[model samples]
Target chain A: MGKIALKRTSLYASGASPVNLLQARFYNEDCLVYDLEDSVPVQEKDAARLLVYNLVKYQRPVGKYVIIRVNGIYSEYIDEDLEAAVRACPDAIRIPKVEHAYEVQKIAKRISEIEKAAGIEEGSIELWCNIESYLGVLNAREIAESDPRVVALALGAEDFTASMKAARTKASLEIFYARNAILMACRAAGVEAIDAVFSDINDVEGLKEDVKLTRNLGFDGKTVVHPRQVDVVNAAFTPSKKEINYALRVLAAVEEGKRQHKGAVTLGGDMIDKPMELRAQTTLAQARAAGINV
Target chain B: MALNIKQTAVAGTMESSDVMVTVKPAEGQGLVIHLQSNVLTTFGDQIRATVQEVFSDFGIRDAEVFLVDKGAIDCVIRARVQAAICRASGEGFNWKGEDK
Candidate 1:
């Protein structure tokens, strides 16, 4: 058995009306994320911030993680959003539309300043970057690897498609390279890679397809706009029984081979080498974190 | 009757069955509500939680509430509770109230 850290899959739901409070309650039970940028209109942004700050004062749910998705680093609202995040002390701050590692450093520096000003410990906050543009995709690896505070990198499909002037069709071939690149970067950096939201709330089948593709691409999880999408994303990201069984088998075989003085072993008629063993270990760890028995 | 519809005060929409209200305190009085609905089990708690959130401006104890609902979204719950409170308190409500 290996130690695993499970980052809760939170639905970034933010709109006026105790959206922050609703998120607070939900996150108390499950992972819930609040977005103060795109989800809120300009006029309501400050109000949203205020509500979020106030809500964070209350006791949060046990084992539920809270993340505030702030505006883009380049946006004028980023400063205010940062101030709010510092005041609220959410588990993580998601900086949307990040293009470069410098942006992460910039936000981290600002967070440090705020922590200093607020008498909070420096580097206590975590950062999550949203790779929503061509430049962001190109720099995804560097960005994820730049700051230790970067817990994950998210791929924003809608914004990415818009930025690339490409259509989001059933196949989504246009964004294939970007998705793979982000996943690779996350893996290289040993952080989570989150997939973008499915825009068509009504198109359940389409959303399912997208989830399947991204999960197959090694995305840790998907961001969901609607509550109905949560169950599907969770199911897609969770390891199947077959995978869990294989992981269990692999571990058992490795243990046995080690006992027999064999350097390698075979499972499912394939040789289980060091890489396969490492993968099996990781799979088992992930399954356990997701509450699936291997 | 299985349910009762009481209008504390009306501002935006009351013509159709979709009632709307904004709960506010009057100069010398407060809002009280007594509602019973066949909406569903524990609907009272849901409505009460929402009313408290939407009208946090008013004193919770000073406000008395009663609601009969036929399954409503959070929006409708807030609207109806506010309308009832406004009607009971005799205070004018701004239909475009700030979101919770």
Candidate 2:
């Protein structure tokens, strides 16, 4: 995964809902995660699998990262889920409730076999792990470092809070440790960290603040349920005009310093060093990715 | 093997998010399709094309497909029809190794 643009909003559409899936492809979500795990009924899994496979094959998700959230490794349907997901040939596979490195390894092994047998270019499909449990948060680093195919680690708040016997709130003070742990592990492992979904669709203001918190907490983006929340997440991740201007100034200062043969320069009474310049460059990159004319 | 719908069967939901497909044995020759859709005028041709492709893939010579579509695309429509047909004809779904 060499420098793929991160989706500011990854909207999940039920793979079983053909109507929704079709409609979702037209939406402006940067990433559309077609879910086959919790959304599809146990009985409909087989049929839904085929439906997702065909949809991915036929539908060209232009300018969107198409990811299929396959069933958990422990589930009986995981084999079938991986088979359909790989054959569908989505851009990525999001493994739910990944608690151990072995889970990532297992999925990688299956993806490799399927890619070869199906004649897909090897390593073309990426992997995303979901840190949804206490164990998952604890072993997030190992799971993230499990394979090169793992590009992003998403936090599943509903399951994590349930596992910890804590209530999930709009303020989200409960899953603080879980979020931080995953974020730190991802940063250490050099993978993207995505925040969890905000379930209350009616509470727009609450969602706004939640997106702000995720962005403030260093998450790259959020996992959203409805299409309406896409823009909110996108705006939250995109660099503001003021921020972009400041970043530009910092880079200018760095260039000036290099021209003068000075070791460094200061901005806002703080040293504008390598790390700060890198952060500024990243902000500009993010602005570019979000289509903001920085 | 020329397969025919043995009974009337429905798969999927009529909800706004899903598509409902109903299949039954055809009383007359050829395929009869009565498509009820919200985007009937705009997407009618596409819907008919999708249903035709599914029927051709399954080798069904005669069947009546009554689709109450809630804006389902080709993929969901294909799955619902396949499931409904499998149920109507009393056959198992071997949905593996069919990917091209």
On lDDT, the leading prediction is 2
Q: Residue A92 of candidate 2: its Cα lDDT?
A: 94
Docking class of 2: acceptable
Which residues of candidate 1, in runs, are more than 4 Å off? A1-4, A19-30, B1-100
Error of 2 at A94 (Å): 1.2
Q: Candidate 1 lDDT, tens digit per residue, A127-218?
A: 88999999999999999999989989988888899999999876789889999999999999999988787878888889889888887777
True contacts kept of each: 0.00, 0.46
Clash count per candidate: 17, 0
TM-score of chain B of 1: 0.51
Chain B TM-score against the true chain B, candidate 2: 0.89
lDDT of each: 0.69, 0.86
Candidate 2, residue A126: the lDDT equals 94
| Candidate with the greatest TM-score versus the true structure | 2
Alpha-carbon error at A259 in model 2, in Å? 2.1
Model 1, position A69: C-alpha lDDT score: 86
Indicate the docking level reached by candidate 1. Answer: incorrect
